[model samples]
Target: MSDAARRTVLGAIRHHLREARSAGDELPAVREAGRGPPPRIGEREDLVREFATRLGAVGGVAWRVAGIDGAADCVASIAAELGATRIALSDAPLVRALRGRLPASATLVEVADRDAIASCELGITSAQAAIAETGTLVLDAGMERHRLASLLPRVHVALVPVELLVADLDAAFAAYATREVPAAITLVTGPSRTADIELTLVVGVHGPQALHVVLIDGA
Candidate 1:
């Protein structure tokens, strides 16, 4: 672009920054700090296990894996255990690895339409990241094509990379900010749940009835 155009863009950005900073916001001290919950840092194995535990606590099942092959095995096993005859698996490498290997007893569909997957009993995909505090799985549109790939099916299986596990929401936000724009970003916590009627709890009223989180490590 021309220098004039560049200057015009920069001027607008600077103006916006000036307006934001001049809003009389409280400036932080040089070393501002607060006492909050301690960060839950752990090794890959420990973190993956904790992630599985949280997913389970929120009415979702979780599996642990050492690598891609193990992940593939877990996927096949889950499909079999659930008695899912038709399943939709995402385009992620982890899901792709299970393509031909899944039991022939079930029909494994790849890159199928979300609505088609909705008709099936299972759907699997990889997550962009997962928030531990809220037990949320972050699904970036770019990685999974559409958020509904994980949401609209009866049973959803999510493959979460151990390295992408963040301790809390703040960390999740930071991780999201660094990524390119996606068609959508979904933060899913457990199955679709609501306490709408007289504070009574209900499940599978809105989204998938079951969520399976497979936390993959060292891959």
Candidate 2:
């Protein structure tokens, strides 16, 4: 790409846009015209099951538990399996409630403690919303320390209530639109992954090696 070629392309794009606007066509109209029909999700489909399947397909684990106690037990079992000595926890109320139920073997550390976060083996936080279609967990920055708690650890655990689950991204977006936007929003589908030029797949290179999501009922 030469500079001249780049300028030509940009100029062409501007001309096209101007022409469309002069013809009473707007950007939204163009976008709507180009968009395809939304995906059809069966009304009877179990969102939890759909989310679990999609998460599994992306190399993440998902569990549906009966209540907070069940969620605690699941987290404790995972911590035991990983032999995590230090766990980082975000400031979300749902995550805080699990503090009393955590295993004694692992010490809980605040996500804001930079030194402690560096040594933490696992992170536990709460997700604001989850998309069943893609098995994505939506984390809002409004919840203090969730970003570091989720990202800077070997293992990440997300405790999501059943009511927060949505059928697709459209529904998730609509839900967010009803409230004030956060400073940042992160959508995580699975553990971090990257591939080389040879198409070789690698996992956990950029973020947590393992991701565990527990969906709690009767929140």
Candidate 3:
């Protein structure tokens, strides 16, 4: 509130930054030491199973399809079931592949059109990476315009290549650390949900009511 208080806060931040720089290469090691042992989730199929299980537990649906065509078919089936006429799609290559495969009744809306995306019944996007331990889908803004598409629709569909699946949050962060960090990284585990003080749970209060994850096995 006061100028003196602001100066004190800034001074503390500067001192912390100086100490952090002094740690140099040892900083990563220190940070790692503070975290306990990572979870022992198994490899390949096991990871997929775990991800699906966790996602379902949180009110999300998961499907493992054979290829891109299978993914398209799955999307079409969902669109038919929901009677979705307008679908918001991201600009990602994988997501674009489903353009012609959707049902004739459904129309594709580009993610760039914010107004259309807001009114769409379904949103389709590609996941940069997925965490098996928590069943989280990582959407990178640097990769495409996926934020609004994933958030503004009644149902959200994410196409994730099998290769991008990671064992845990640690592995996901490690993968991100290899490159320049994106401006925004969204970790979505399930549909939006909230509860009142009496603990009466409600879904789709702020975002999509349903989340569907289609993991392409050999894409």
Which of the numbered candidates is closest to the native, going by highest TM-score?
Answer: 3
Model 3, range 1-219, lDDT digits (tens) per residue? Answer: 699999999999979988988878344335565765765556889899989999999999999999999999999999999999999999999999998899888888974878989989999999999899999999989988899999999999999999988899888777765787899999999999999758988888889999999999888
Per-residue CA lDDT of candidate 1, range 141-219, in tens?
8766546568777888888777888877777766655778777778888898889999988888768889888888777
lDDT of each: 0.78, 0.87, 0.91
Measured with C-alpha atoms, the lDDT of residue 136 in candidate 2 is 99
Question: What tens-digit string does per-residue lDDT give for candidate 2 at 99-123?
Answer: 8788798899974977788689999
Q: Which residue pairs collide, candidate 2?
A: none
Best of the two (1, 2) by TM-score: 2
Better of 2 and 3 by TM-score: 3
TM-score of each: 0.75, 0.82, 0.85
Q: Which 10 consecutive positions of candidate 1 have the poorest summed lDDT?
A: 29-38
Q: By how many angstroms RMSD does model 1 differ from the true structure?
A: 6.4
Tell me the deviation in Å of residue 3 in model 1: 31
Which regions in candidate 2 have their CA more than 4 angstroms from the true location?
1-45
> In what order do the candidates fall by lDDT, top score first?
3, 2, 1
Task: Quote the lDDT for 159 in model 1.
Answer: 82
